[model samples]
Target chain A: MRIKVKFHSLLRLYLGFGEMILELPDRQDITVRELIDELNLRVGKELKNKLLDGDEIKKGTMVLLNGKNILHLKKLDTVVQDGDVVVFFPPGGGG
Target chain B: MKSELSMFQRQIELLGTDCQSKIADTVILVAGIGGLGSVVAESLVRFGVQKIYIVDNGLIDAPDLNRQILYTYKDIGRPKVLVAKERLSSINPSCEIVPMDEKISESFELPNDVDGVADCLDNFADRFTLAELAWNKGIFLVHGGINGFWGQITSIVPNKSPKMKDLFAGVDEERQQVQVIMPTSGIVALLQSLEIVKLICGIEPNLIGKLLLIDLLNYDFDKIEV
Candidate 1:
């Protein structure tokens, strides 16, 4: 399956890239956690820690699927199918 | 362009014709012409607001191109308020577009004629300044903000209503940083415009005394009662 990933704000520094269209292992069903783990491995330990804490992704950062928010979905367990677009963003909060 | 009073025919049928006329006659001021303000202004004009005052000092830039929907590549170096006025005028020439090409500062003098204000500023300092100014002038202010997956929208009538500064109290201006996402910004702006119209129509707004929190990642729309 191919998923489009987007990175925003401070996370962009660690991601070393702004966005990417990548191929994920084809599974009948997948969770956000599973995908995060794979991204963690690809992004390396130091950068991953900046975005994730222990085994969980930080709450401050948001993950949106297509135009819908993942928080409205199942969170980490939000299932993904083919051609899903996932956007990761750490929004500026001062304004 | 016909009255389009018929476009509002359904709402008039529900709220009665008198209140609908009040909305059609109301004049609104939108403070800021960036990501959030631009959308709020456009939405209000689309809903048939009779007059709109757009305030801003910044010029369009590459970064703004991402979320500030009102401007395009040709607008890159132009003042935002002018572009906003041009675009909004094109959208609804029936509504008067008053362009105040200045930053909302502590010494700002709001026009005595406007009915309400929409706070779409990108910083807390300016927001507080505008809030104080509006409060002193007895204007109802609608506030909206978005950062990442979290966003909030609320309306304040100053001393008449629970003050927003009190609810989000003790906020340090220096440490505060705002991160914006396109979707959340657009959604919150729409909600702000809706609240403005409700106020114009003398209808009770949903976020009058509450903060609407939207976490897009989870798609959870939660309200925090103040």
Candidate 2:
């Protein structure tokens, strides 16, 4: 299974560009945290902390699956399947 | 000379005589006469809004020239509220343009008769302050926010709507950490202005309780439930 991931704002500085696709094992579903961990392992440490803190997100970025926000849905434990599009946007506070 | 109202003939036809009259008589308060506010204010005046109150404590700088369309080379170093008022008034002299000439602070008080508010401010402190003030007054506040090809617009109807703070828990402190995009501001402000018009005309807004999120890069428009 494959899912698309996005990084925005300073996270973009760490993760670079806007979005990418990841290949995950089919039939082995993972929570949002596990996905970030996978990204951290692949992208390195500096990028992981920007999106995840300790065991949770930094509370600044808005993680959206499809068009719905993850917070309103299931926080980090939200399950991701094949072809799911996950967006991580650190909302700019400048307006 | 053609009637300046001619530009709004199509809109008047849709709103009819009664609602059109109401829209014309309505006054809007725009907090932060920069990026978003400037475009919102300009569009309102062009659409024949009778009066507008622009509040801002910012000055025109070199960096704002990109999307702050109301200002120019000559207007540089001038107060944003003053310049915006001057430009909007020139665009439609029949309408009244009030310059609040101040920052959005704890003391900000909304006029009782203000028809609506456009939250085009650049900082969350001001945005939150103005939203809270408008909500307390039971006024319609159309919030517009944008950054890096992403933007969202929501209409806050005070007690009847979800509080802005509830949707965005702690974005105030993270203000400086975010990125600002030029096109996003214009698009968001246009949507915000349209929301204001719909509110004044007693029409249903698409963004009443929902946030319209636009991802320009992907050309995808999605709504996030507040």
| Top-scoring candidate (lDDT) | 2
Question: Candidate 2: where are CA atoms >4 Å away?
Answer: A1-35, A38-47, A64-87, B1-4, B172-181
After the best TM-score superposition of candidate 2, give how far the Cα of residue B158 lies from its true spot, in angstroms.
2.5
Q: How well does candidate 1 match the true structure in TM-score terms? A: 0.68
**Model 1 lDDT per residue over B22-45, tens place:** 877788889888888888999988
Candidate 1 scores a chain A TM-score of: 0.82
Best by DockQ: 2
Give per-residue CA lDDT, model 2, range B111-172, as digits (tens).
77787899987767677778889888778888887776777788888766677766665353
Supply candidate 1's per-residue lDDT for A77.
83
Q: Report the error of model 1 at residue A8, Å.
A: 19
Every candidate's lDDT: 0.73, 0.77
